[model samples]
Target: MAVYRIGEILRMKREALGISREKLCEMSGEICSPQTLYRIECGKVKVKRETYQQLMSCMGQLPERSYASIIVPKNQYLSIKSDIYDHLVFGEFEKAEEKLLLLEQMMDRSYPRNRQYLMKYKATLAYKLNKIDAEEYQRILVEALRCTIPQWDEIDMAEWPYNEQEMEIIFDILHTYHALNLDEKYLDACLKLKMNIERHYMDDDYYVTWKNTVHAIISWIISNRHQYEQSIEYCENGIEQLKKYRIVGNVNRLVYDIFWCTRQKYIESNLPEKEQAPCNRQLAQAYYLSVAQNLQSQSEFIRKKVKQFDIKELFFL
Candidate 1:
């Protein structure tokens, strides 16, 4: 079966050399059609050794002296890595991590700095594990960032292929750092990267998604510092942008976070009844599970002190 597949690779190589199926049939004096060529390429049909040689001769190109010249019976190293990456994108973090560990063992450490794809994968795995020993994770991030920047710069912006999957992996790292709240510099770097992505890849959907994410993170940071007005401004700008671009997936999450922040602001300001009520209702509904778990504490402390509003009436409204 494997030998048959090897013959198929040879057929594809011939076709790629610009040798038409009809031309190959004429040169080799063998009956062949485009459908026959496809079947061979797909490994559903086998060819005799002499037929394979004749086919190669017709194309005036032959496999060279390289590992890829001879097809391996089993999957190649990169193929397995590709499969693992697919699993990672689909949220199979555990299975992806297991395969990544195996891949690390097989890696040639002498070429440690080579293979940008592998480095990116390692960075992504570290992010998934939430391995937050800063020095370690940042080391991986730095390498991945270095690789990504150069690639991003060289491509023609007009025709560049946006790797959404890779972008998502990097976003995971950024979101992780945001969660830890320990690496402001790294987070800033992430925001700069997000801006670069938006500037150059506006046509790509990821641009909007990442932009909203960064906006949401920035709003959170500002809100934590008690910069309520600035926080609301950032969140409102982000929400407006998301709406403008019709990016709905993360908009709701951002809205929920923004509402919570707004509620906090109202409580801090001791805002008037009419103004605080809406924000309170929004926070309560968005964070119902948290509020439920701490209902007594919330009523005694948060609800009581946030005296401008009535939770019961707000919920009814």
Candidate 2:
């Protein structure tokens, strides 16, 4: 049984409400001090059942149920939240907004800070609906950014895999809203944050993989923006760095493919005539061959691993 301490539950609820510790203390009319709340959330102290119920009741306005009944696997909650966020990023504003409301109700005030994310979703939804209230939307985004800033610091970027798919989804959202400048700023911030994470927390393997992934994506984005030279430079840098670390795996191979594809594309785009440049063609062919060989090796490796698995061990019979 995965039992959470009482304090942990309270803290999660407070965060879900998007209320800061100080704000929670104020809202609860000093029933709990910020320090006390922090202690409780951190599982340093036990909260009285009565006090817990009181706090829950105070913040349970959205969900007409007790927070205790809403417990489930943490990953399940994350998946649901990710799905809603995906919809928001994909321009399904109305549907996302509806889902956000439902999520809020389901959350029952757990992890109140997540309310910031919900607010961001609603603001973006409003923008999609042609509600030209830029001021309000920007305010919500700023609030969400404020909450996210600290989390960026906490994340272990090097070993922690980049959510490339989610990044693309967010990029699309910003593009749809004509917020390219904001998108660029966010990407730059993420890159810097990842660098910090690598510097402070990552092991060698993690650090190498993280750096390569960031560079590859950054290069891809710059290439799309017509900064071909800068893009190629980033890709080449990533490939060199990954090779130095000997990070041989699916991710490394993918990075290699991206580097070669982007390099070839950039060269092709710059050519003056229909005829292929000999140097460019040769380089492209080299990269293509490397990519094919890497993929073949990976497929063979996976087949061997699968062959080693004992299916009978999974069955009672």
RMSD of 1: 13.4
> What residue runs in model 1 are displaced by over 4 Å at the alpha carbon?
1-93, 99-117, 124-132, 148-187, 198-200, 272-275, 284-317
Candidate 1 residue-wise lDDT, 168-227, digit = tens: 446655665655666575447555655555543334455666677777777777677788
Q: Give the top-scoring candidate (lDDT).
A: 1
lDDT of 2 at 139: 55
RMSD per candidate (Å) reads 13.4, 13.3
Per-residue alpha-carbon lDDT of model 2 for 20-122, expressed as tens digits?
9888778777887888888888878878765676676676422222323233346456566667767765567777777677677666444444554555566
Candidate that scores best on TM-score: 1
Candidate 2: stretches off by over 4 Å: 1-79, 89-91, 128-136, 145-191, 200-217, 220-227, 236-317
TM-score of 2: 0.41
**How does each model score on TM-score?**
0.49, 0.41
Instruction: Kindly give the number of clashing pairs for every candidate.
Output: 0, 14
